[model samples]
Target: MLKKLNYTNGLLNQMKHSIILLGATGFTGKLIAEKLDKDSVTFTICGRSLEKLQYLTEKCTHNHECLVLDVMKEEKIKSVLFQYEIVINCVGPFNLWGNFIRNFCVQHGKIYIDISGEQSFIEQSFMMDKLAKEKGATIIHSVSFESCMADIIASEMLDSALKYSDISSYYFFRNSKPSPGTKLTMQLSKHFPTFFIHNGKMENASPLAFHKYISFDFLPGFTKALFMPYPEILFFNKKYKVNHSASYLMLNHSDAMFLLASRKQPIESVDKILKKHQSRKHNLNENDIAKQEFTLVVQAIAEDGIKITKYVHGRNMYGITAFLVSYLVKQINSGLLLKKGIVTPSETGAWSGLWNVLIKEKLITHVQELQSDEK
Candidate 1:
């Protein structure tokens, strides 16, 4: 169940000097740091390596400080986190170190955000909801390119419906390659069972269940979308009261099949391979990112047989994520987010305005809505 907490107005305005970013030396972390610097936002960068942190700080156009602290050290983590009003964690495979920071934020009543895409980590976060509400802590995970985008599009489509509707299906399509961080996260998740929402509850499902081809209005040929477990299944199902929903990845059939087959390998071997991949420099270039495109298609059906089909189109997942995190920080700093507690992007009161900004900035290129004739 979702917990509600009171929003302390003027709280954020008082926290001018209380922002720190964890994992500041990572690939996505560096992008976020660059964005923060370009926006002239005053924030401290932190990670385990002082050398890398210093390098990032120096690269920033705006002045920023760097701190070196390992998340595995509880006392050290708490001591550093206590001084910040908000922390944007870019550390990946969040199932490992995410809980430490989340617990600190809740205990200190500090706002927390992370770019985690791990379903297990997200599901585990729900247990903190009650404590977070009591402490007046606001936490939002999976603020990255895919999960948050899926949640926002789902919320928008549900809100636009004339009647109560159940999310029938959600589809994710990206024309770009995954970042090293994303690849590592995917590798880590290979051992976990895939899940989908059915009758407002989550159930384990077979990988083969999602192997079928799906058609999209924007694209000509049918594309295969593999069944994937995204955080939205839990977040959106609870917030929107969705009866049934599932997410699919737009991948070729062979690629999807290979991913499914990979699950049978030992976790240790998979982790080793992923670690090697993560060590390589695999940043997406501007020219490639500029050519990248992502699209989400959501279909919701009301009890009376009416159907609402919505399409949200965007470009460059990584660029959009950086812009989103920066925008969210600015809003939180301005006290624009009125709700406090563990929340999703759709549940935030500032989402509608943020949506407009996304469109204006071309982070979101188009949103189309269509109504079925049955109604």
Candidate 2:
């Protein structure tokens, strides 16, 4: 349903940065802008708040242009996007505000990236594959802490020639706080169906559809894990051609808010609640980030009954997200993105051994692999 647009001018050579970042006033957006500025990558930051954007620019070393543009204005967005070769979107509740921007980028053959973890948004993004390939545009979603680690670990586990029958990823977070954008996305996601790969096909289910108790080597005992739909569920299944794939999140009753909103709650009611909730909270501070700990466990079951489990330990989810997005943007600019259509973080092969890079930067503390035979 999307058509490609032809541009006569070579905008890539004309723009100083060739990159435009939307939602630069948001939490993750600010971090990404700071990281890019620190790395000396000149870019233009656009958002609704000119004052905040100017304040951000004042603190940065580079003179990145700041533009006050509302995302809801399609014509203005299209005009601005025409001048950039790449667009990094940090807008939240992506299922709501993500469509026009993504469609515009794909139609215009621009490299589009977003840190969206909303499963519905991710599924919708996947639908753009055909159109993206036709337009010669590369669209990648969820390149942040949400599912990049899972994709990376799964790609590593598939290094052998063996065919995997099943793939599972688990996430555990400690001493961390969700950013306002993340919180809103979580609240909005409850309205969408959860998904997983079954028999090499995608299926929808309820949030926390399947629950079980599982233990990791790093944990003291078995903990409750809920089957939470994630971006990697689709990525691992499609990228690795696996028959079955699922992902889980470790949570307790107190963490029920992280799982799903009440089914009886109306959309208006939820929005009102979220507006109030987000106002009282701010981004994670350094002390909170210092205490943050996370573990990503990935397991793959081969057709021959052999299972390989890998673990990645890291700190500060948002920090990792900022660094990863910055790294991916750099890779894109350096011509490392080889695919022409919609892609997962690991599909481009640029992320191969990225775990090592994280480890080198002290973002990740440990990486281990263990193999066993299913009885």
State residue 19's C-alpha deviation in candidate 1, in Å.
0.7
Candidate 1 residue lDDT tens string, 1-375: 111212233122233457889888877788898998898889978778867876776678877756676777787666567768889999876876687788788877888988887777777677878888899888888787777877776777675334444564444555677777777777667555556787768887754455557666675554776777777777766676556777776665567778668767655665576678757778666667777787777667776777778777888778888887887888777777546677886666556576577788887888788888556
Native-to-model Cα distance after best TM-score fit, residue 155 in candidate 1, in Å: 2.1
Cα lDDT computed for each candidate against the true fold: 0.73, 0.79
Worst 10 residues of 1 by lDDT: 1-10
Among these predictions, the greatest TM-score belongs to 2
Collision pairs in model 2: none
Candidate 2 lDDT by residue in tens digits, 228-261: 7888888886677678888888776557444544
TM-score of each: 0.86, 0.89
